[model samples]
Target: MAKTTRFATLIILMALACGCAKRSLVALVPDPDGKSGSISVSNEAGSVAISTPYRATTIESAKQQPTAPENIGKKTLDRMFAEALSIQPARPLHFLLYFENNTTLTSDSVQLLPGIMAAIKERNSTDISIIGHTDTVGSKEYNSELSSNRASTVKKLLIEQGAEADAIRTTSHGKENLLIPTGDNVNEPRNRRVEVVVR
Candidate 1:
């Protein structure tokens, strides 16, 4: 299979594995008077179980379909959902940085560097893709070289910011994939960009 197809397949498999893994959650909030709080779980089998604080519950599926608890307050139920949402798995992030007239980073792009670096640091595992693009302002040959240089420059910056150099893969699309399609030789800043995807 082609590399793109392989990469896409790998992503789909990872998502499926995450979705299908045996997942469990435990809720252990104390009541106001130091009494025990409770949690309830119900499965598709129409069976239900209830437990006190510190007990763990196995969520059967990604939906985590749960029936109402017997004696839980609105606030406590809201808190449960809030905490559950916060603990979901991280999703892929994309960063788009535009270039100046030629090869230099635009001011906005410079400001985005810190966010990109922080994301790299925050993730436990990193797989990065950087693709450089350019406007239709020059000959195909020259634009291709320029786009490659732009990608190289971003890769260097990422490496300098403590990213593993070997983890990054870059390609140049030149003027072929314009963010804003236009006539030839137009100076479109949006088209002159480097797209970074962190997974």
Candidate 2:
């Protein structure tokens, strides 16, 4: 079998040793958006795939197989991993702003800029990413430049709204990474977009 990393983005394995060695309790949890993804736990002793939210397994020893995942209550999770969960950082926030064409933001997106700015202020966000994308309606070189311009325009607007310039970064994907994929020379409004992430 191919080797795999046993890691979790939300909550990883929580071990409460009872004067025992190589024993652990692992739990799967929902992400900030209330969605849970699958994970696999394996070793030379055994392997198991777990996908259900709030499910847990007990590994008793290196030679013994991990117990089958069973549905567990949230209260149990809180009690068992209080300190670990409390220290977890708040989830990052994401915003998508659509464009009319080229570097111009649509009317709705223009209105959205202020709200994004407000969120940045409220979070006291120091890390920000602004990525630009364009529809596949032009040469790749032209679209690349257009996307770069779009990101720059958003950076300027955010700075005007009091966002710290040093905390923000910009990148352009041109028509290479489209929100709505399309054939060459096609116009896709959804593809003309700028995505912002505040952390």
Candidate 3:
């Protein structure tokens, strides 16, 4: 029985070692909107394409180059994939800040300021999205205005914390999309929030 178990483990280890020896193709393309893209890979006679909004696929597998009238060779494809990997940029990071009832001041939200600023500085973020949302406690118009104000407030704070003003874009969803859906005139604490996307 012990010999059988040892033999099975050896087979598994050999399989894993062989898998690691295979070559994989990876391509990083920027989306048309500059916010998303996709990656594709083929291994062991199978192929797959992965769609990504702000991140790159991390995988290691053998790749099959597409056949065309030009008849691109595997050597060329391998070189292209190598170059892409060498120059691929880092992926963007996301952060969320929840606001207090009818106010942009939340203890937890305030505490995130330093970390957000540090990430921006460390990653050298150039583009950022500051979107604000609110609960369904007031008229649509009023909520819209309040959400915009909240987003603006966060943007200001980010700038003061060393973020570039020109790189920040602020938008207000108002009460249109609630984190915790509720009926009209309802005050959902979780609904009042701001989302920050740093790229």
Residue pairs with colliding backbones in model 1 are none
Query: What is every candidate's alpha-carbon RMSD to the true fold?
Result: 15.6, 7.1, 11.6
TM-score of each: 0.56, 0.84, 0.61
Which candidate tops lDDT?
2
Off by over 4 Å in 1: 1-88
Q: Model 2, which residues run further than 4 Å from truth?
A: 1-18
Point out the higher-scoring one by TM-score: 1 or 2.
Answer: 2
lDDT of 1 by residue, 61-178 (tens): 6565643223333344345478775776677789999999688999879899889989988884468999999999999999999999999999999898888988899999989999
Question: Per-residue lDDT for 1-199 in model 3, tens only?
Answer: 4543444354346556776664332434445357645555555656556564322222343444421112223343345468766776777878889888765569988999999998888878888999999999989999999999999999999888888999899999999988888999997878889889988
lDDT per residue for candidate 2 within 1-199, as digits (tens), equals: 0111132211234342255665677889898888899988877789888998877777878788887787665666777789999898777889999988767899999999888988898889999999999999989999999999999999999999899999999999999998876899998999999999998
TM-score (C-alpha, index-matched) for candidate 3: 0.61
Which candidate model has the greater TM-score, 2 or 3? 2
- What's the candidate order when arranged by decreasing lDDT? 2, 1, 3
lDDT of 1 at 16: 69
Give per-residue lDDT, candidate 1, residue 85.
59
Show model 3 residue runs off by greater than 4 Å: 1-80
